[model samples]
Target: MSLSGKLETDVELKASAQQFHEVLCSRPHHISNVSPSKIQGVQLHQGEWGKEGSVIICNYIHDGKAKVSKEQVEKIDPVNNSVTYKVIEGDLLNEYKSFKITVQVTPKGTGSVSHWTYEYEKLHPGISHPETLLQFAAELSKEIDSHLTSAK
Candidate 1:
């Protein structure tokens, strides 16, 4: 099997695309408040939030295990409502040689859809595809949508 691969999942949200994208790009640290069970905390380690090259350390839970991922904001395209982050350190690096995540929110009628992409290369072929992590992200998206809709 190939050691490098990409996985994607789309989550439907009641919030507008702009609102969802703004939360991720401008205020990701607030995600911990909306999805405390999944994301415990997010701290800016360098630069500023939402800007490319900024680094953030995220404390989260995956598959019932607490994990930390320090990632650098790689790109942010406001026109497309997309943000990409490259994992530079922490738990996931233990299994994967490299990992990148991109989130794009697009308007769909009255609601929106969040498209999540996970691109990674494994340290060895023994490592399984990150299906569980994708599910975690999708669930986190739903939680954020719930919070955004309720707040308005």
Candidate 2:
């Protein structure tokens, strides 16, 4: 595999697209309460919640291993319902030189489609691709999708 790569996952969620976008933009801090099994907590280290340039620290569990990701909100597009996060510090940094995750939601028939795009550069050629992390994000999305779907 290449040292630098991108992974895109489209998860179809049975929830309102606007609501999903709102959750990602304005209410991401509440994600822990909405889906504790996927995310334990999220705190704003700088700037305001859901705004660009904000730094967020996320505590989550991936494959039963606890991980912390310090990320900055790089971009937010309300019209497109997209949010991008660039990871600055955390365990992944030890293995990867840089990482970014973008979440986009689009309305589909009777529901919404979540697009997860992961862009990363590995520290070395021997480092494995971040498939597990992608899986973790997909799992988290599924959990949130269910939570929102059930609440409505």
Candidate 3:
């Protein structure tokens, strides 16, 4: 397998795409209240919210264990309904030299579909691939979608 690669998946969701984008880009901290079991908290570590270069620290439960990710907003495209985060610190760095995740949501008739992409460079050949993490992302998307639906 290549040391550096990208993983992409598109999942259809019942939630509005624009609402999902807002939750990710602007009101991420609110996610904890929406899904307390999956997401613990999202705190801005530096810069300002909803802007490129802003760093956010995310705390969540994955694989039944707590994890943390500190990432910087590399880009935010409202027109495309996409947000890109480049992980700079936390548990993920233990296995990857660099990691980036891009999430894009687009309208799909009455609902929406979320596209998740993971780009990473492995720290060593022994390191496993990130299929589980991608699945985790997909599951998180579902949780968010459910939260949005129930908030109505």
Q: Which candidate is the best by lDDT?
A: 1
Question: For residues 3-82, what per-residue lDDT tens digits would candidate 3 score against the true structure?
Answer: 99899999888988999999999889998987788889999999989999999999989888999999999999999899
lDDT of each structure? 0.96, 0.88, 0.93
Q: Using lDDT, rank the candidates from best to worst.
A: 1, 3, 2
Candidate 1 residue pairs in clash (backbone atoms < 3 Å): none
Q: Model 2: what TM-score? A: 0.95
List runs of model 3 lying over 4 Å from the truth.
Answer: none
Ordering by TM-score: 1, 3, 2
* Superior candidate under lDDT, 2 versus 3: 3
Off by over 4 Å in 1: none
Error of 3 at 72 (Å): 0.1
**TM-score, model 3 to reference:** 0.96
Model 2 Cα lDDT, one tens digit per residue, 1-152: 57898999888889878888888777888899977877899999999987999999999887788889999999999999999999999988998999999999999999989999999999999998888878877777787888888985
TM-score of each: 0.98, 0.95, 0.96
* Candidate of highest TM-score: 1
